[model samples]
Target chain A: MRRLRSAISTASAEFQRHYAHNRRLAEELRERQERARHARPQRDLDRLERQGKMLPRQRVERLLDPGTPFLEFSSLAANMAYDGESPGASCITGIGIVSGREVVIHADDSSVKGGAWYPLTIKKIVRCLDIAIENRLPVVHLCDSAGGFLQLQSEVFPDRYMGGRIFRNQCILSKLGVKQLALVFGHCTAGGAYIPGLSDYNVIVQGTGAVFLGGPPLVKAATGEEVTVEELGGAAMHTSVSGTCDYPAGSEEEAIAIGREIVAQWDRPRKWDCQREEPEEPYYDPDELYGVLPDDIKKQFEMREIIARLVDGSRFHEYQPNYGTTLVCGFANLWGWKVGILANNGVLFNDSSLKGAHFMELCNQNNTPLVFLQNITGFMVGRAYERAGITKDGAKMIMAQTCSRVPKFTVMCNGSFGAGNYGMCGRAFDGRLLFTWPNHQIGVMGGDQAANTLAEVKLKQMQRNGEAVDQAVIERLRDETRAAYLEQLSAWYSTSEIWDDGIIDPVDTRNALGMAITASLNAPLGESGYGIFRF
Target chain B: MALALLLGAEAAGIEIVRRRPHLVVRIDGREHEVVERDEADGRTRIELDGRPLALACAADGNTRFLRLGGRNLRVSLVDPRDAAAAGEGGGDEIRAPMPGSVVTLHKAEGEAVLRGETILTIESMKLQTALVSPRDGVVELLLRGEGQTFDKDEVVVRLASPSAPGPSEPAPPEPATAEASPAADAKGAA
Candidate 1:
């Protein structure tokens, strides 16, 4: 219960510099979000309005409870994909409260490319469904997509996690007793038709909404049958004739109102309430987190200072505080939910690896959730450390962490390389959620280190082959490899690939973690046990 | 009505016996003079029988941990019904719950100390874990101290049974004075 005696100098020059840099970064993030939100072309909005249909965003606004928060995911998805054409992947996904129940909202951005499912659009949709499944929250699909983007079907249609996985996830969700309501506002043709077909409830708008395996043009092409879209699969036909949809509405407003009423009829869930003290502002300003993280990934900063700014009231109960020098393990409250924190202060040596293993087990035993703050260069590897069985020690940690039943969250605060990524619950470990900061980078090793190591290998090979060891060739190799590493290691690149949930601003870490933790409580804690250690 | 508390394994009956002219608390069977000396900024300073003790106490539900004398002591307010349901056991010797290296010892072997007095400090994961005495008695053996590493549940200190003194028993020395020790530095740092 000890309130941390802060060692950070809040007013120091370094702190001020960090605060200024972070403030600018936060501003840039806001600008990007604003631009992405407003990027829809004016013509598309007018066209939807002319057709007596509401824009995707307008539907979401009407569906959610008034004045509630909406935590959007990948707002800039497909920004770089589709040759920079698809804005927000031509779709919108977020968590918002509707009918006083937290639900995942998946809306189609018809303004972009006629709401076609680009490769990135499929990705964004799948990710949102994954969130719905994990949190056990009901999903409301604002289905208006124009099927798959034919120009890039190669990328969208043939992968395990692509177009087909959408229906697969919906089936899994239904099996788990989670509910879904589909509001069809526009055409859902071909593969997209299954969105409403698989949902537990479907509401279709009369004029624009259609659900069919093949649209009218496709039907004409396949069988030379000329039929109108409304006669083939419109709201009236589906609700009365085919019985495919549950509710039929005359307009967009009527459809959303019906969706809200249906959600209210469903049983309310008993929210998980964690044992906690009243929430308090952190003793130290979270802004200081900017100053605490070094601009250069190679440099080190005190992790406790960052923890002080993230936890409730900056209070912590450190477990086994002194022995493991490179790792800090303790328990703190994030938004009043108790979480066991394992943050790296430096590289993982034998002692730190063992400490991590022990701390993870303790958290699981206590039914506390885990949060990993990773800024690591990987496990210590040298003659002295190898002699101490560092590899086996690291394996023990990985074994324990992999088997832990409690939910885990991770943040790549800075450098994440090699085995350190696995040890810290990186992408491979299936943490409930993972995020990266703008300055964060991840690779098998640092760019400079990888460049130097590869260059050395090539130079030695040239010597052995009795060839001229040109310094120019070696320099070019290093530069090329370093550039390639930097490109792949950027947070934006990782986020575009869905390597993490999203890239969050450093200052928004508290709220983001709070929301994530709350959402994670949808599932009960699993039984505690871990794999056998290597001794 | 009475309540029992288990502070790091030692059970005690605590009751507010009197509240006039300064609060009096009965710990176990003895009444001690107590008062809230000062309380501000999450820290509480209390005078126990004339000796001032400063603590930073945080309550999580019914379980509270007090950071006193440089140690985080998990204090649980036990329900008398539950305590009577579970039969008592014995682990008279002090043991470590996790593996760690002993940092510093405030007293030597065979030194007499009061219940709840910190015996030594152990360092693990950059945290100093204070090893406190569960009962007032002579320290019959200081198993591990000062730079020595020990495993989980390994005894670090042992107290003589209240009646029979162990072998090599030294006369119970006067209780160690607080003014000359470094433990004073731990007051209110929480």
Candidate 2:
């Protein structure tokens, strides 16, 4: 009996101690939960807005560190009409911070009238592009749209392209150094496809979202192809072929997470890309190309073959397959260096001078290499010039080149004359090296020159009275004199020599250019950067 | 395959009256000889005053190859500083070259714009990448907003711009011994 009482008392004491400890632990847990709940809770509206379910104001939360000091620009931006009217506006863009990186974004929500881009959207985007280029910012785009504005097309009306004035901002971005990327969610098609297409990197939600150049209806009408929108322009289609999107995701959350992840891929201003798994040997040796071209100036040549032979064959890209025909410009891999290259075409005259200038400009902008092959005669002169508006159109080329700061090289294949020589970076131009085939002959005059010279000599000798053979000699000498004048002009040391950095054997031209470029790269800075001599 | 060769008379100093991008030559060595070519189509063209000679050859003349005159030729023109933007793959903006209705702003204005981001959704060729922003910049301005239209690569946004202005400085020298390429960065961040 005594032992049982003692055991009961001990057990009661143990229970009291256990109850007090449990109560204290539970109290602490509740307090921590309360604090966490109040600390920067994710706003429901913000989540809904991103899901294409709310307005911009509703989606925007404190984008900076909660309760930390930060300045807000254009804090009250909204689509409130002049008369306080509520309308369909799809994009919401403004300055804010996510983890301290100051950035602006143009977000389109598909739930809002299919997220169309109208005149206002164009202006808004242009403004964003211009500002980014001018400031060299790291741009981010949060995209979710069906495509263009079908309903609001009539709201902002203009005679020419409906307010396209701000469209040039893209070039400005390219000219300057800036970083851009696209994130896709929901249905993206047609115009929406480009958002990720032209970016440095693209991320897309695999199953929940898709991107295409045209939606199914348009596709069916245009090409009689009645496939689903996603089937035609899905994440896989974009990332694998067409060289459009770079990254593909499985879900919206994954896409956004990838967006945040990609944004931090490079340091603040510097840019970057992923290296693809490729073969060991390059496409071909640039040196083995001595016999790939025909000596005929009028013959056609495969430009891509040459590029493949010169660079890593498997790692080059060409843009605008149908735009310019006179010249070629794109990015390529040389040795291990990533670079931009501009080449002149041998058979197309889409815009010779204009193409040349563009090459120069691209070289300067991207610090790439510029190469030219001398294959010319004269532009279709006179009436043809008027029809092509050569003067106005051609000048833009020079402007682009004149502003370039990249290295340049040229090879003289055949007959270059007048502006022709200039176009090929002649002694009077900016080629790092100039070389010509042994069988080359450049002159200002052709066929009639030789005939005239012989005629002039014969007539002069025929004069027995020693009287000067005036008119006959003059008329006969016309062609020959012109040829001789051209010859002398080309040979003048000042004309081609002092003006050139070097001249080499045609076969060794590529090596010589490579050497010169290595030596002059990022050399002394100056006004002579890309300026044309004697222009 | 039609070709022509041009040469300076007497091989003296070269002079010029004009320079165009492409040229064709007509040669005759056999009965009823003929050829057609588009050399300048895929190659870079230089308009320098030099000599060129056209030659005739067999019709089966290695169509897979490029023939210059009677000899075969190949020319390479790749740059040395390609990267994200000018690199194989990177994000870039495609803005409008001029204002127009969002007649077809296809891509989402914002998202993960890769090296070739196409935000404006422009239309040309009855087709378009039509407008793209050149460099990587965040969509800041977007004056047109969606469902509206505007002109050119305008200030859509102050994208990719360093959030806040850095020192009133300019582009720094390229980093030597690059620890990471753009591609690596993309993968690393992921």
Top lDDT: which candidate number?
1
Q: Which portion of correct inter-chain contacts appears in model 1?
A: 0.06
Taking all chains together, each candidate's TM-score versus the true structure is: 0.75, 0.30
Q: Residue B53: error of model 2 in Å?
A: 62
CA deviation > 4 Å runs, candidate 1 = A461-470, B1-22, B25-190
Model 1 Cα lDDT, one tens digit per residue, A1-535: 5566554455656557666776676676677667667766788878877888777888899999999877777776765555668877788898889998888899988877788988888998998999888778899999988788998889889999999999999999999888999999999998889899999999999988999998888899999999999999998899999999999998899999999999998887665655666777788888778776765565555677778888898888777665565677899998998999998766687888999999999888888889999987788765667888989999988987888888899988887888988888998886877877877888887788889999999999999999999999999999999999898887766776667777778878888888788877886666667767888
What are the DockQ scores of the candidates, in order?
0.05, 0.01
Give candidate 2's fnat, 2 decimals.
0.00
Per-residue C-alpha lDDT of model 2 across residues B33-152, encoded as one tens digit per residue = 223333555443222124434533323211223344556543222222212223533233233432334544433423333222335543211112223433343443444555565443
Looking at model 2, give its docking quality level. Answer: incorrect
For model 1 chain A, the run of ten residues with the poorest summed lDDT: A1-10
